[model samples]
Target: MTESTPALPQRPWRQRYHVAAIGWTLLLAVLLVLSSLMTGANFGTFLSNIDQFLALLVQMSHPAWSYLHVILQPLYETIQMAVLGTTIGAVLAVPFALLAASNLVGNRLLRGLIRFFLDLVRTLPDLLLAAIFVAIFGIGSTAGVITLAIFSFGMVSKLFYEVIETIDMGPLEALKSVGATKVTIIWYAVLPQILNQFVSYFLYTLEINVRASTVLGYLGAGGIGVYLQRSLGEFNYSATAVIILATLVVVLVIDGISNHLRRVLL
Candidate 1:
């Protein structure tokens, strides 16, 4: 026993716990627990209420196929509104993106101002904008179009400028050495590199607007969502299921088209 006790176990200093990481992890866990409590997110409550959710899901699973014909036109209108709004926004974003790009616009003050304006535009929620526009434009597709256009503008401009900033500087410098005008240099150097990416972003925004237009329709902005509201108000879960399924199909098609366009363009 004395001989065995002579060699004590060596401390593994190299394998010691990281105090800072442990402290941070514990702090994060405490915050999550506090947040869950404040939000009334107890597992017991969820378990008690789960039956109602399951019943609703079961009702929604059996869709009213006959309702499809009635919703087709409104679905078409939603797609039309998305296309118009996204086109308008994509076109308008070009100039703003050019002005905002650090590489393109060397003026720090100007870039800051443009970025600030864009931030302001993006700060407002699209639903709030739709409500405001609905009031002004009298609750029609006009309000929806304007709302989608402004929303698309904010998103596309930010994306476009980020793409522009990543482009090769060589062409830009080459054009400058030949004394090319700003427009000429952008046309020859910048546009060629970023145009395909711009098209890709445009299609992406269009896809999103297609879904958003349906939500905007809730405010009487004119789309399938108007019918969706009515179906829910009447508690016709079958019809509601039909609407949801149709919307999902539309979104899937948009995704396919966007991918095809990206491949062809790029």
Candidate 2:
């Protein structure tokens, strides 16, 4: 009909960026394939062997309800361990978190040292910690409790210090201007502002500790994991199913409580 409208030319920078993104994506895909090959991970093999997994699932479909009575004591022990460990760790983390907070601690060197210590603590995986504690404290719930406490301390301290760093400085400054002591300023200015966040994080840590305590039991730390290990070893899928269902119920209950508390605090 009329003269055709000319297409707008793409920007050189835009075209280069697009090409770079595509290149990176292709490289990533190639790396993934290479890594899978190196690890002997074959999707085709998994697809072919999937029926074995289905059979296992069928075995677990019917839970042994009577197993609940036997596990009640161990489950109670697990909950108690989580509560005690969380309390101990959370209480201990306050001073360490304050020391680690860059905003609170004016000395960069001191903050760095505290953070380094925290990093060192965090480097030890939970399973490794449990094993170490089990060796030191002997095989019992005591080792599990100690492991949970250390794990919670490392995690909660990091979370708390980050929260401290993000707090509004205005109240802190105001408190300082009134010649308030460090502890007083923290109690009045900082803690109030971050109290809700602290509770939320503490609850989150408690929930995690519950799951972790179960695993610690495998190393003779004492919990439901011992039973889980035994069930798998004995090929008792029915008992394993009951244990899994009970743990799921406990997790769901904790989650519900955590959600409710978070909503109230928020």
Candidate 3:
């Protein structure tokens, strides 16, 4: 007869861990219920309001095609603002990003300071920035451009430095051993490896700025947003729909270009 093997016993720790997980899950469920109650999130109210929401949606369903001709100029201006802002921000971010890269900058304090400044810039709301710029620059696309540039700088710098940190250190060390200056090493060793990634990030930032520029116009910074606000104020949902559709088309075109460029770069 063949010998039969005994079944292995379950460990006490495993049972305890399973029980702990159940307890934590129950606690989380209780917290979720309590929070929902505290926040007054009533599903019944939403259900009651659904008809009104659908009515508004029905109104927006028919876009005003004739309004498109009128908005073409403002739409072009919005694209221009996004392009100018993204370009300025991306160019200015390069040196700061290099400084913020922990591998590139040996001094921890300097990197910390640079990172802190980036954080400060990122904390400023874009709408508030637009408002401030409008006050200073006096209601034009220039204010929109400046606002977008600052916003893009904060975002792109963080992304660039993170990309820099992930780069292979082998090239850097190789350059350093050959008696190269810091700038020379960066130019030859660092730029080549991360160039594709940088371009991809820049394009991504540009895409975002295009969307942001629309809202900036609400602050009198100049874009189709001014028309959007006017249409909404005048209760002209058809024109508002046309503006939204136009903005969507611009976003889609930018996205397509960005995808094509990324494929080519890769």
The number of the candidate with the highest lDDT is: 3
lDDT tens digits by residue: candidate 1, 1-266: 34555767775654366666788899999999999989988899888999988888888999999999999999999999999999998899999999999998989999999999999999988788998999999978888889999999999999999999999999999999999999999999999999899999999899889989888888888888889989988988889999999999999999899989988988
Model 3 spans > 4 angstroms off: 1-39
**In candidate 3, what are the lDDT values of residues 1-266, reduced to their tens digit?**
98889878768985857988898999999999999999999999999999987887888999889999999999999999999999999999999999999999999999999999999999998899999999999988999999999999999999999999999999889989989999899999999989999999999999999999988989899998889888988988988899999999999999999989988987
What does candidate 3 score on TM?
A: 0.85
lDDT of each: 0.92, 0.90, 0.93
Ranking by TM-score: 2, 1, 3
Candidate 1 clashing pairs? none
Worst 10 residues of 3 by lDDT: 7-16
Residue-pair clash count for candidate 3: 0
Q: Tell me the lDDT of model 3 at 117.
A: 98
Pairs that clash in candidate 2: none
